[model samples]
Target: MVDTMKAAVFQGEGRLEFEERPIPQIERADHVIVEVGAVGICGTDLHALKVPPGTLSRIPTGVIMGHEIAGRVAEVGEDVLSVKPGDHVLVDQNAPCGMCEMCRRGRPNYCISIRNVPGFPGAPNTYGLFQDGGLAKYVRVRELNVIRIDRSVPIWQAAVAEPIGVGLHGLRKVNVRVGETAVVLGAGPIGLVVTALLKRSGVGQLIVVEPLELRRQAALACGATAVINPKEADTVERVLAETNGTGADIVAEAVGWTLDTCIQVASNGARIILYGESELDDVIPIAPTLIGIKELEIYGVFLAPFVFESARSILESGTLPLDQIVSHRLPLEKVHEGLDALRDGRALKVVIHPNEF
Candidate 1:
């Protein structure tokens, strides 16, 4: 094994340089060293780079950028027994200590102790943002972050596992059922994954709302029966009319940029899932009286917990065209190109290959 490995290091805001660093040795018994094969570009990563390096800027210069990756264990320490060297796997970016209140409750995504704070004792500061990333030849995996995958799942598609897991987790908790109609707002990767899961989960009908022509078209490809361009029509009125004027049975707001989009577009008793981040932008306006009169269930899906396995099942089932959502692939040296593409909305999901680069 080489003493040094290739890593795409983020030196500072707008400064990404691919360089060589010493291969991280297993610092703990439970740690595993993985030779990273692929990592996907996520929107939040781009948002971090754009907005004046606030919380994410704490990441410091020389941090690796990608968490979504599939690789094989090159080495596992003495305490690591769940997997072996040469085993194909995808690492969970979010983690919780088994003894923490959140983990004890089976909601590991909200791991109280390690919740989003980088540089925890044995955690990777890079995987979920703080240190080095997987846009390199190797990534060090903390015991909790690693999951062995089916060797058959393509390394490229396995990158979908994490994001898809998030969608599945929300649906599992949303209390959805077959024969119900849902309106998935937002046609990004996660949005499309949610729609695909809803269809495979047997929803009666799905109407996807997106202003982007490309994303709206992709939504249909992901099994949305109808697509609505929010910019082209009155979304609320049209949705109500499409659902026999009663509105849909469920409304999953995948576009969370503003609160306005989360308005009730369902019948008297309906479930509205706030699955998108844009909802963070504006206050959701709706009559408090309506929520009371209609008996509504509104849920906020933060991330996945205890649902990676189900997500893998959905991906393995080939329920959606995972291949199409990913629009570009560039070498690690072209990290800026990938980030730029994401920033401009020119690509949806782009994979980075440090090895190939």
Candidate 2:
């Protein structure tokens, strides 16, 4: 095997440099080396690349940045027995310290050690964000972070499992009921994935609110019964009309900046899941009394903690419109272009093939 590999290193805010680095070897008995096949450009990556950087600015400079990853196991440590070499696997980026209070309480997503906190002394344990991730030909991951998948699953498709798992986790939190009205406040990747999962859960009317016509069409393909263009009409009015003036039973604020609209269009006792991550410094004005008066339950979703296996099963079923979700597939060298496409609102899920380049 080659000794050096080309990796996309995060130099600083708005700087992602491709440089040759030594291929990682198993330094510990629990380490596993993977030959990365595909890495999906997530919204977090864009956040990390922002001019002043978003919440992910805590990522130390020089770390490779790609979390949504899938690849073949090239080598395994002596102590790793869960997966053998040549196994197809999905990388669970959020590796929480199992000994943390939150982790012991079964909420590893909020593990204090790796959780994103301003000025927190502890470094994040997440891959791509704080460690060398799969944005290169190879990456070294702990065995605990690797989940083996069927060999028949396409690497590009497997790379999207993280987002799908995120959607699953959010949906599970809300516990969508059959024949209910659901509204997704964006048709971005997470929005679309949630929309598809909502449909599978038997929602009667799945409404998607998106300004982009292309995504609206994509939402429909993902089983959205109705779509509203917020730019053309009042989103709240349209959503209420679709629900016969009662509003949505479940609302997903997947656009980050549309929490107000999600609140405005939610029916009494509606459950709203905040799946989008906006700028950390950004805020929206909302009347707290409105939530109390409506008895709405609001939930904030973060990283996928325990839903990777479910996501793997869903992907292996080949039911979701994977093509609709994955809008672009580019090589590693064109990572900048992929980021640009996502930033320009021209793509949904962009998968980068590091080895193919």
lDDT of 2 by residue, 38-114 (tens): 99998888878888788645578999999999999999999999999989999998888889778899998888767
Best by TM-score: 2
The TM-score, computed over Cα atoms with residue i paired to residue i, of candidate 1 is 0.90
- Compared with the true structure, what per-residue lDDT tens digits does model 1 show for residues 106-172? 7666666445434443342447366566887888878767788877777778777888887877787
Q: Which candidate is the best by lDDT?
A: 2
Q: Local error of candidate 2 at 58, Å?
A: 3.3
Model 2 clash pairs are none
Query: TM-score for every candidate vs. truth?
Result: 0.90, 0.97
Name the lDDT value of residue 95 in candidate 2. 81
lDDT of 1 at 158: 75
On a 0 to 100 scale, what is the lDDT of residue 305 in model 2? 88
Q: Stretches of candidate 1 above 4 Å error?
A: 53-58, 117-128, 278-284
lDDT of each: 0.75, 0.90
